[model samples]
Target: MFSTSIRFSADCVDDHVWLGDLEAAENTFMLDKLNITHILTILDYKPVYNKDDKRIRLYIEAEDIGSYDLLSSFETCYHFIENAVQNNHNILIHCQAGISRSATIVAMYFMKKYTLTHEEAIEKLSNKRCYHMVCPNNGFQSQLQLYHQMNYAVDKTHELYKDFQSERLRTNYGLEKSDKITKTEKEIIDDTDRFPIKSEEKTLETEEVEYQCKTCQHKLFTRNDLFYHQQGRGKSDWSTKPLELDETICDKQVFTYYTDWMIDVFDSNVGDIHCISCQTKLGEYSLDGKKCECGHWVMPAFHFDQNQIERHNEMNHNHVEKS
Candidate 1:
């Protein structure tokens, strides 16, 4: 059934914020009765209603697909919502069916305003609109978890943003992952595998831990240059699925943020990773980043294949004090 029902937040007795579908949003009687001052529209296209009506509407273009990034749009919507909340004005966040897209925004807003976890926020929202069944898709759910991990602010350096950007660009350039775009791959052969490791790069940070080529056991990065993500900490990057899964389902990979030795690769924005010792092709990285089998992303990605390299124990490395 199409739910035109305009549901109020279960927690707020003042009835300042509301959730519903396009039908409810367009109803003049409801708006007049509730005194709605602002409408935050989350849809791929704009909507036109009565010609005589004039009300403030903020439109955000988005889709309901799990991979569709609504996390990036949260702050803008929240800012508009915050103004209304402070001024004691009514605001409605709505999408086509008032299911995934608008519901996700409202869920996130509640999470921020109340300092609640994703699960807690969803439970609270569902308490009010249980008939609507407010459940964000797995991707959106994962992003909400990430939002909590990041303390409710967008972390651009996070890998997921990189993956999202990569996916979006691929769509824009007609080259999403499904297209299997691999035009700039460097022709690396076993004979040409050995590249000279600069002495300056090697000795720069002796005290920090690093990853090593598992095969030859030679140090990969001079120090632990692992791009620390909030990933593998809370739940998992962009995944709300069961942790135990088939091997084919989750291909775990790692990424190192840009470092001094990688300045050349960053120039072109895409390149392959090779062991400095044996020159074996370990993995590949891109400024645009390769998305993981799980939905996580990283940008300026400097990830190495887990099969080719091993992480050096941080406990074994010494900390160097800067002079």
Candidate 2:
């Protein structure tokens, strides 16, 4: 059975851009409801969709794995989205979960078109798409940083350009370098030169915050049961460790079910957690009290997944309302 947690609603990021998961993108009824005129699919393999003459479709074959070169498709996908939006056509971009691959593309689009930094673009997208989570993987994050440096750096002369020059030098000197400098290596060089290398240490900084169900505004987890936690030490950290749900948190607040993907991946009977009242997916919970790599035996709470719930902040709520 498909878990309700796997089901997601399309979120409008702007007047012309909508972000959603594969399920929402494939849902004909949802697409019609959103009046999406164009669809952009990013995946490792070819996407199979019902042929719809009325809706334009663009498929980008790229793996969601960190090693995949997503940068190659950035320019093409950006222009495709730009052209569609320029013509007043609403576009929906999707990947498997709309959390990584598709989110990275949309964030890059925002950076290129709006001249926003990586952080700014992510925040903007998150605020607009109040439901869906927008967490790009580490590889994508580094690439985006490089993209920002190349496109938005105040100093025209940066190490990225210097690295390109060095690569040319190595090639000219007949030095044995790889036939092609992979995108991942380039990003590493860019990062090493531009910023301090990050450490592997995981630190949990918790903030007591009230969270409410995104669908019905029902109070679910409060400061006692909910706390925002980041894994890494730096501002450029991409680790979005789930919110820690106290074991004492009311079990009645959520219902549990499992998806095939979860069962296959976790290799155990794991259930997707969702709000009991609105049936909105909160996150995945471990019935066996599994311990994460961080050595914390906290339940896996995906309250950070914007689709499930949001931190109860009056200012943020007002800002969302006004926007």
Model 1, 1-323: lDDT tens digits are: 12334543222312588887777777766676678878888998878756766767899988787766687777888898888879888888888888778878888888998899999888888887866767788878887888888788776666655555555444433332222212221122111211222212322232334577888987766333444332222235434553433322122456554443332222134678776568787778775665554444565466777768764544564433323
Q: Best candidate, TM-score-wise?
A: 1
Candidate 2's residue-wise lDDT over 197-313, tens digit each? 122321121222345677888766443332222222222222355344442222123221222112222212245556656767766655344333333333332213445665554
lDDT (C-alpha, whole model) for all candidates = 0.63, 0.59
Model 1 lDDT on a 0 to 1 scale: 0.63
lDDT of 2 at 140: 79
Estimated TM-score for each candidate: 0.51, 0.47
